[model samples]
Target: MIACGEKRLSQKRKRPNILFAIADDQSFPYSSAYGTSGINTPAFDKVANAGVLFNQAFVAAPQCSPSRAAILTGRNIWELEEAGTHGSYFPKKFTVFTDLLEDVGFEIGYTGKPWGPGDYSKAGWTRNPVGPEFNRKKLTEVPADGIHKTDYFGNFVEFYNQKGNDDPFFFWFGCHEPHRVYEDGSGLKSGKLLTEVDVPDFLPDNKLIQSDIADYAVEIEWFDQHLGKMISFLEEQGELENTIIVVTADNGMPFPAAKANLMEYGTHVPLAICWPAKFKGKRITDDLVSLIDLAPTFLEIAEVENVPQMTGESLKDILFSDSQSKINAVREFVLTGRERHTHARPDNLGYPSRAIRTSDYLYVKNFKPERWPAGDPVPESAKQIIPAEGFKELWPGYQDIDPSPSKMHLLHEKDSLSRYFKLAFDKRPMEQLYDIKKDPACINNIANDSTYATIKKELRDLLESELKKQGDPRVLGFGEIFDSYPRTSKMREFKGFNKRGKYNPKFTQKDQQIIE
Candidate 1:
C-alpha cells in the first residue's frame, strides 16, 4: 500500500527513467504478494504494493524468445515473421522501441539476458534490440547453485555511472535465474519446508515434484534479491520516484505443460508497475492485458512520435487512471500463441496454436492437431543423446518439454502418473474450450460438450476473426510459412521425419548452414 503522504516529482523534470526488470520462466501468483508459499519475493511484493498489481497479465507467446520479441516490438508473434518463433532470426525491418528511445536522448543499456537465444547478428542488427550490453560486471563470490554469476545490479550501477548528467536512462534488468537447471533441494536447504510447496494439480502431488518446485522457488528468490538491490540503488541515487519501474516475467515457469503450452499456467505471468509520482499505488486490476502493450506504453511515456507498426495498444489509460479495477472496460480479451520452441519435432517443426482468453473462458485452436503438442515420442539419433551446449541434457522423447526432475519422475513412473503425463506430452485436439473459473488447471476439455456448444462456437469464431484481422499466416491458408523459418539452434532428427517428408531443402539447407 502507498504511504498516507507521498512526494511527487516536478512536472518540468527530465523524461522519466525506465527500469524494466523481467524474470525468466516465472509464473503468475508465484510471488509473496499473491500469498504464495515457498517462494519469497520481497522486491516484487514491494513494487506491487507500491503500484499496480495486475491479476490477469499474459504474454504474447508461451516461450521465451518469441515472447520477449513480442514485448520488444509491441506486436503479436504471428505478425513478426521469423522473430515470431523461438531461436530464429529477428528480421531487420522490425523496429524496436528501445532503438526509438535511443534515437532520442535516453541512455539505453541492458544487463543479463536481452532479446535472444537467437542471433540478432544474422538479422543484420549491430546490437541487441533492447539496447547496448552492460553485462561487464561480475560477482566475486557466487551466491548459490544454478544462479548466474553475472552481477545484474552491479551492471546497472555501472550503466548509471556511464549515463550523461542531464540524460534520462532506460535500463533492461533481465534476470537469467528461475529459467531451469535449478540445484536440487536448494529451497529446502534455504530453510523452506516441503509442505510450503503448493503443487499444481497437473503434476503429481508427491515429494519429488514438491522438491522440484521448491528448487524453482530458490531460483526465483535469487532473481528477486537482485531486483531489491536495484530498487535500492535507484533510491540511493535520488531517482527512485522518477523512474517508471515495470516488473514482470517473459513467460510462465518452465515445467511440463506450463512454459511451452497455451494454457493459463503457460501464458499468464505476474506484472507490477510503480511510478509513485505518476500512477496510483496499492491498486490491483483484473482486466486482461498482454505483454505486447508494454512497448507502446514505454514509447508513449517517452513522448516518442512516429511509432512503428504494432498490434498492441498503449496502457496510458489504464496506468494513469484512478479507478483500480477495470480501468478500461473495452480491454476485455487478450490473445496468445506460439510456434517452434526447441529442436524437438521432426525437421524442426513447431506445434502452432493460438488462443483467446477472456475473464471467464479460454479458447484454443490447435492448427496442427495431427502433430504432438510436446514433441515426437522417438528420436532418430539415439535413445540417450545429450542436448546442445549450455542446455540441459534432454532424455529421449517429449523433447519440447525441458528436461526436469518432474519430467523424469513422470516418465519413469508412467503407469501411476499416466493421466498427468498425457496432460503434459500427449497430442491435443483441433479445438479446446476451458472454463477458467471452474478449471484453472485446464484438465478437462469441453470443446465437444453439447452443453457449452454455443459458447465454444462463439469463441472459435471470435478467435479466428481476430487472428485473421491480425494477418496471422496460420489462419490465412499459408500456415506452412511458419515452418519455413530457419531455426538457428541445434536440429533434432526424429524417427518419422523421413517418412513424413515435410522437410524442404529451400529452408532446411539454409537452416543447416546457420546451425553448422
Candidate 2:
C-alpha cells in the first residue's frame, strides 16, 4: 500500500524527519484498521487512514531481542552473530540503523527499549549499541523529579526548537506496554468493560480471558496515547506533515502458540505508515510486507546509496506505479524463525524452528522438534520466576500446569489437547503445516496426514528452499549446530515466581534435555 513515486519523491525533496515507533507485544488483533480482531485503536487507525496500511506484515523473529535486533540492523538473527536470540551474547560486528543514519548527517536518538543486550560497556558492543558511542548533549544529567532518563520525544522537541528546525532528525520511541506482569481487572478499573471484549478462539472463552484481553487493550491504548502525544508535539513544532511516521511493535503477545512459536500469532504484527503531503489516505492493501523490508525502504528514502548485506528487497515496487493498472504486491512472501526461548532446560534447550508464510498458508520446519514447544515439563515448583530484577519478571510461565479444575478438567477432557499441552510444553515434532482457512487457531496438525500429503510436500520444499537461500546449516545436515551457539543470559533459569514460595530451579542442562 505504499504511495506512488516514493523514490521519485525522495529524489526531489529534502529527507523527511523519520519518526519510527515500536510497541511491545502488539499484534494485528489490536488494530481497528485491520478489522480482523476487535479492539479500539484510534491513534493507529488515524495513521492507517493518512498513510498506507499493510494488511499482512511479518517480523523477522518472534522474540523481543532477536526481532528488534533484526529491524534495527537490517539483518537476520544468524547474520548478527552471538546476538542471534533472546538474552543472547552479542559481539561487536553488527551496526544498527540509527548509527548509519547519524553518520549521514541526521540527528538520531532512540527512547525506550532498543533490544541489544549489552550497550557497549557490556561484552558484545563495539560501538554504542543504539547510536553514536556517546551522547553529544549531556551524559551525566538528571531530571529534577529523580528520573535521570532523558525522554526521546521531549529531547527531539528541545533539539529542533533551538535549532530552528533546519537539521533533519531521526527519532525512535519504543513502548513497553501490553507485555504482561499484568494486574487482572486493571482495565475494568480504568473504566473498560470486559463484556465489550471479543475473545479469540485460541484463548479459552471465559471471564478470565475477557478480563485479560481488556487489560492488554488498556496497555496498548496507553501506548497509543503516548504515540498520539508525540504526533501532537510534531504538529506544534510545525513539522507535522514532514515527518515519516511508522507505527508497529516488537512481536506478538506472550501466550501459548504465540510469542516464541513459529505460528502466525508469534511472527505477525501490526504495521502502519503515515506521511501527510506525501501520499493518498484511507487506503489499505493486502501486500505481504516484512518488517525487515523497512530498513531498505528507509535507506532508499534517505538517499543513502549503499545497501547492507540484508536478505530483504527494497519496497520500491510496492509504492507508486507509473502505470495505473500494474499493482504489484509489497512482498511476495515473508520468513521468520527462532532459536531459543528460556533457560529452563540446558543443552541450551532450543525450539529451533523456521516458518514460511504466504497469503494463504503457513509452513514450518522444526529441526529440534524433539524439544518442548511450550517449555520443559517439571514440578509445580519448577514454574516460577525466582530472581526477577526490575521489570523483567514478565515472561509467561508454565501455564499448562495450573492445578485449578476449571482449566485442569478441560485439559483432561480433550485427550489430544492434554497430550499436546504436555507436548507443547515439553517437546515437539520435526515438521508442521497448518491450513489457516480451516484452523485459524492452529489447533490441528495435518503434517503427516495422507489426505494432505501434497500440502505437506509443498511446504517441505518451500521450507528447504528458503533455508537454503539463507544458508541454514541445519538442512546442510548439521542439525545440532544451534546447540553450539552460546546461551548468553540465564534470565529465565534462576528466577521464577508462581503460586508457591520463592522457587529457584537449580536444574542442569543434561537433566532437562528431552529424550529423543
Candidate 3:
C-alpha cells in the first residue's frame, strides 16, 4: 500500500549507516586489542572481535590537518595544494567525500573535531568539511586531564534524534583525546601502574617517561569509552546490524620522534571496521591500508559514483569477503609523506620528506638534508647568544617534536644520554633505510651500508616511481612550491629568517598547474 517513492526511500534506508570514530594522536599497538598492556580499550576490542582488525593501517601524512585532508579526499597529500600543508587554507576545488555523500541525500553530521586545525572557512564552506556540527552538549566532569570535556555520547544521542527514520546517516565521531598537555601523574592516579607501560627503544627507560606514556594511555581510554557509548546507542536504536563502524586515529601519539616524523610509529595507526549485515566478523588482516582508502571505500559502500579523481583503491571487496588470505594479499605496501607540520623552521619551512614502507623495510628520502630534521637548532626563547651546552641551544627549536617528559629527560641528561638525544634531535643524511621488522623504532639508519644497498635502491626507485605516477610536485622538481604555499596559521619569528611572513618569490601562480 506504500507509494513508489516511499519504497525507494525504504531501499535507501536499508543501505548501511556509517559511524566513523577517530581518535586524535593515537598510535598502533596502544589498545588492549593489540596486546598492548598499558591501555584497556574495550570499545576498540569489541569492534575488532566483532569485525576486521587491520594490522597495517597508515595515514598519508604524520600531521593532523594534512592527514585528515588525505582521508577526506582519497588522494595523496601533495596533490591537495594548500590543504596538503599544515594549517593552510582548504581550496574549494578539491571535493571532499562528505560533501559528495551529502549531495547524494545522505544525512551527515559530526561531533567534536572535524577536519581541521586549519582554516576551512576561507574555502567558502559554511561548516566543517566533515558535515554539519552536533557538538552543543557538554560534560560536567571529565574522567581525566588532557581530555576534552565534550559530551560526545550526549551529542550522538542528539544527532540520532534529529535523523529521519528512513535516512541512512553518516556520522563522524572525532575525539580530541591523547593529543598534548597531560596532567602529570594522572594515569597513576587513575590506578594504571607504570610497570604496565612498554617504552619504545628510541626513548630512555625512566619513571618520568613511563608515567607520561601512562597518561597518554588514559586519554586513549577516554576516547574508547565514548566509542563504547556510541556503539551502545546504535544498538539501542536497532541500527547496529546494518551500520558500518570504523575505529581509527588521525595520526600517531604526540611525543618526541613520533607525531611529526615519518617513522613507523608516526604513520602507523590502529584500524577496526565492522558491519554485521554485509561482512563476516572476527577477522584480522595484515593488508597495508592507507587512511585515504577509507573515502573511496565509503563511497563505494554507499553506491555513490563519480569519484574518478580518487586515487585510492576501494576496500569494499576486501571488507565484504570472508576469505582472510585473499584480503591480505590485496595491498603489498603503503606510501606516507609530510610537508609543513608546524612553523618551526626558518620562513616557516617544513621538513619535506617522502617514505615507503613495505613488508620488511622502510626507506625515507629527506629532500632537504641541510635543514634540521626536527626543527631549527636554536630555541625560540634564545635570541642572541647560543647556550654553552649543545642540547640546551637545540631545545627551543625542536618544535617539530612535541614537548613531553621523554623529550625533557633526554635533554636534561644529554651529558650522559647523548645517544638518545641524537637519535631524536640530530640532523640526518639524504637517504635513510631501516629493516622495520628488526628496528621498528627506526633509530638505526643503514642507507649507506653496503649490506642494504640493494634494498635501499629498490625502495627508493619504487617510491620515486609511485610519486611520479601520482604527479607529486616534490618529485616533479617543484618541491619548493610546498614551502612556497601560503600558510594561514599564525606566523612565528625565527632569527636569520627575514621572510617569515612573505611567500617565496620562486613560486608563481602558474606553479599550481603542476598539481592540476
What overall lDDT goes with each candidate model?
Answer: 0.85, 0.64, 0.84
Q: Compared with the true structure, what per-residue lDDT tens digits does model 3 show for residues 201-296?
A: 888778988999999999999999999999998888899999999999999988877898898889999999999787898888877889999999
Model 1 CA deviation exceeding 4 Å by range: 1-12, 379-394, 495-516
What's each prediction's clash count? 0, 15, 1
Off by over 4 Å in 2: 1-13, 36-38, 117-128, 132-164, 321-330, 379-426, 479-481, 491-516
- Top lDDT hit: 1
Off by over 4 Å in 3: 325-330, 379-395, 496-502, 506-516
Candidate 3 weakest lDDT stretch, 10 residues? 495-504
Worst 10-residue lDDT window for candidate 2 reads: 498-507
User: By descending TM-score, how would the candidates be arranged?
Assistant: 3, 1, 2
Highest TM-score against the true fold, candidate? 3
Q: How many backbone clashes does candidate 1 have?
A: 0
lDDT of 3 at 265: 86
Residue-wise C-alpha lDDT for candidate 2, range 110-148, written one tens digit per residue:
666666443233444545465532122332542111222
